[model samples]
Target: MRIKVSLYARRGEVLDYNHCYELAREIRRAIKTVDPEILSDEASRLYTFSRIMVKNRSFELCRDGMKLLTSQLYFFFSSLSKNICDSLIDGFVELRRLNAGGISFEVSKIEVIKESKITGNEKLVTLSPINFRDRSCEDADFEEKFTEKLTKELIRRYTIIYGSNFDGDVRFKVLKCKSVAIRVGGKKYRAHLMVFNAHGSKKLIEIGYKSGFGTMTDCGFGMVKKAKRI
Candidate 1:
């Protein structure tokens, strides 16, 4: 399940460039608000989110960061568990106010995004960059490691959700990719923003679609959308 959250803020509010961590922290705070137990449950943390998107090219670049010329921005969040999504919605509604990167905003609305049908083969594009553990794009074995890590992570998530081992094969091929640098906890990490083909078990693909790909998804990495064919 997924939801789009719209936030309204005053114009001229400036957001820092390294706002992902703050954004993620605010999301966790919301989740904790409604269901404190969810924070303690490891399985409940299997989720991903997109970067903050300014509406209508409403922001301009400045020395500090993006200066909001408009009053609204939004982001998408997804998870395999309906309980998590429900908790998030309730949390957001109850909290009302959100603070990210030193900027304050009000939660104006929340809407559920309909799921797409998953097949054995699907083209996916990242909404948030994909991060493989201890791997960067510059590594000679990056692609190989990416596939290996992705497969194991999906199976791990499956086991946690189903309480059984996943015996299916997982296949991913990057069609187009580029490196992205991001900071979390004052440490810089290299990730990838890419369009890729995912081919394997439909259940696994669906899991990846809902929960996201690669590692550190809960920290807002590897969120993906079904790619449209041109």
Candidate 2:
């Protein structure tokens, strides 16, 4: 399931570009309120979130960060588990305030985003980007390695969630991509923002859509949405 969270941020509030770490912390706090057990188990967090989608005006970058000339900020959150989504909604509604990287926001609305059916072949665009390599690693055949690792991870996560093996083959082709850097937990890492096509088991694709692709999804990486066209 996916949800669009609408937040009201007053003008003059600044948002750091690398605010994913802070946002993840606050989101976990909200989830902990409704489902403490989920937070306790690291394996239980099969979820990811998109970058803050700003609206209503423009912004100027300053020494501090992206200063808000806007009043509304939105983001999408998705989970493979319905229980997690339900708890997140309830927790956010109860608290109604969110603070990330020293920027304060009031929860304006939370709406469920209806998911479209996956027909086993889909064009996807990343909402938060994807990363699966160690910061020190370099390879000449990085793209091949990326596909191999993604397939293995998808099957692994599928097994964990459904408690069954996925014998179907998984395939991914990057139509276009660009390298990007993000900071998580105060550490910088390389990631990719891309448009890609994934074809294979519908369940596997659904898992990627609902949870995420690649690694560090729990820290707000690898959230994707189906694109009508690239």
TM-score each candidate: 0.93, 0.91
What lDDT tens digits, residue by residue, belong to model 2 across residues 180-215? Answer: 788888788898888888988888888888889987
The true-versus-predicted C-alpha distance at residue 197 of model 2, in Å, is 0.9
Q: Which lDDT tens digits does candidate 1 get at residues 1-230?
A: 98999989889989877677888998898888876778687688889998887899789999988999999899999998888888889999999988886688899999998988889999999989988646766677777778888989999999998999989967888788888788998998888888999998999889889998988898889999999989
Candidate number of the best TM-score? 1
Cα displacement (angstroms), candidate 1, residue 169, comes to 1.9
lDDT of each: 0.87, 0.83
Error of 2 at 171 (Å): 1.5
Candidate 1, which ten residues in sequence have the lowest lDDT sum? 132-141
